[model samples]
Target: MPRLLTRVKSKMSIFAHRKARGMLDGEYGSVFKGRSLDFEDLRAYIPGDEVRDIDWKASARHGSPLIKRYVAVRRQTVLLITDTGRNMAASSLGGEEKKDVAVMALGVVGYLAQRHGDVVGMVCGDGTASRSWPAKAGEAHLERLLRDVNDGTALTSPRSSIVEQLSYVARNYGQRMLLFVVADEVVPDAGMERLLRRLRAQHEILWLTVRDAQLAGPGVPGSANSGPEDRYDVADTRFLPGRLAASEAVIRAYAAAQEQRDGGREAALRRLGIAHVHAGSSHDVVPAVFTLMERHRRGK
Candidate 1:
């Protein structure tokens, strides 16, 4: 666990530096971007400068348009809402367990929050049971939070509904926060969508989907198209049959369904004004997160 923590921190350092540079250049956007600002100086107004920031009196005195400049006052709250259900325990296309990728994703965001002097917290659950750690700052607190997520996921049962866990978050945590929902490839149903909508009204939401190998579709190495003899197991406990042969029709149907499911999920989140990142494997997690942050910063 310590080694994992160290590795995550090392990777996050590069991201943090990139973020810092982006913030300085006004190239990054997200709730993590400090909102509170302290007046720094005045400068000649550029064409695209906000009219609200224009100092009319100063501009009159200087006989030219001028705008106020302020340095961002840094402080924020980031909450990592993780799904520790059995599905997350499955292997991803990139060969690592989804659970491990989740931890690494959480670590990246949490470490970045800490570096920016923000409090980091978590709500982790495996459909049946959920655990939450209060927001706190400092490396020690972040480490403890990671350890708790690791321990909690290890002991929890798999068949838990991520919706229930998210419902818990919507009801319990009231204050406005930057919330990141990290989970497997399950698309939200109508009820789950409603809950997410309600939560979205109160917090800035980001959704990270950790893609599973079984769901990555036909072309992936272990996917149905890999061979006619290949068999795939559906990761849930429902009456949905577990194993399926790699018949051409089955593979094509599975790939189409998976694509539709993933597309629908992304579209729903987009409609709700939630930013999202898709990490296909452990190696993709950090880069995916960085890209999301960068896109948000650019207001895309």
Candidate 2:
């Protein structure tokens, strides 16, 4: 309802002011400044330095730890991808709607692309359909992208299938761009893996998985208090017996399965050479994104 991009910028500004104390030491600016960067010099390691940037051999020689610095070069076209489906309207592990976190993550990355003089575009939909917008540079366009995700995602919407959207990108867009994908935990399949491989060969891919709410638990937001009266299926709003879900055995099994699902997703992305991260709420988006960016750059 209100201006969404402004909220995105506010988060970015928070990260910006933390630059000096941030992992990249303000080099966070270079996270979206295209792909490649020329090697610069090393600086003394700080408390928050990213371990990936540590020149291990150099550190050993220097007798202490050091962080590698680089000057970013070139620009990038960022394509924000997500699934606007009933699943996203459901709650995230962090107790907020998955769609809300998806929007925030998309907005953060899109704004970063904009700040670095890059154009941003989008591809979103569900199991039944897909849609896209042309790449453009402007806060207005980014706002529209965020709104598209926020407005389209609803409990009554179609089922989610991120594979469908990725397939669309592979078929329609030939240009090489940074694909920033945000979606809820999805069951990985061979078809999805194949599509990811195809897209990986054509463009650089980054994935942000929005953690799902705990189904059977005591500590989760909707677990103990919600009882059987409040819980319902996101797909069709069918009431689920919370008593069954609250069982200790059910909770343990659910947790184990979710862990495996998360691991499988991460394994798939890594095996395909794509950088991936997961976020449970808006607060986790920026840092998760930074981690994703760092992984993407290191792969490059």
Clashes of each: 5, 0
Give candidate 1's TM-score. Answer: 0.78
lDDT score, candidate 1: 0.73
- What is the total number of backbone clashes in candidate 2? 0
Q: In model 1, which regions exceed 4 Å deviation?
A: 13-30, 33-47, 51-73, 154-156, 215-234, 238-244
> For model 2, how does the per-residue alpha-carbon lDDT over 145-238 read when each residue is reduced to its tens digit?
8998998998889888888888889989988788989988886688888888888887877889998877666545644555534356676567
Give the CA lDDT, 0 to 100, for residue 225 in model 2: 59
- lDDT tens string, model 1, 1-300? 355678787775666576555452232235544344679999999998789999999999999999999886566678988877677766677757677888888888887777667788888887677888889998778777767666655423566467867888987998778888888887878888899999988887777888877532233454444543332333644332233444556668878898899999988887787878888776677778877776565555
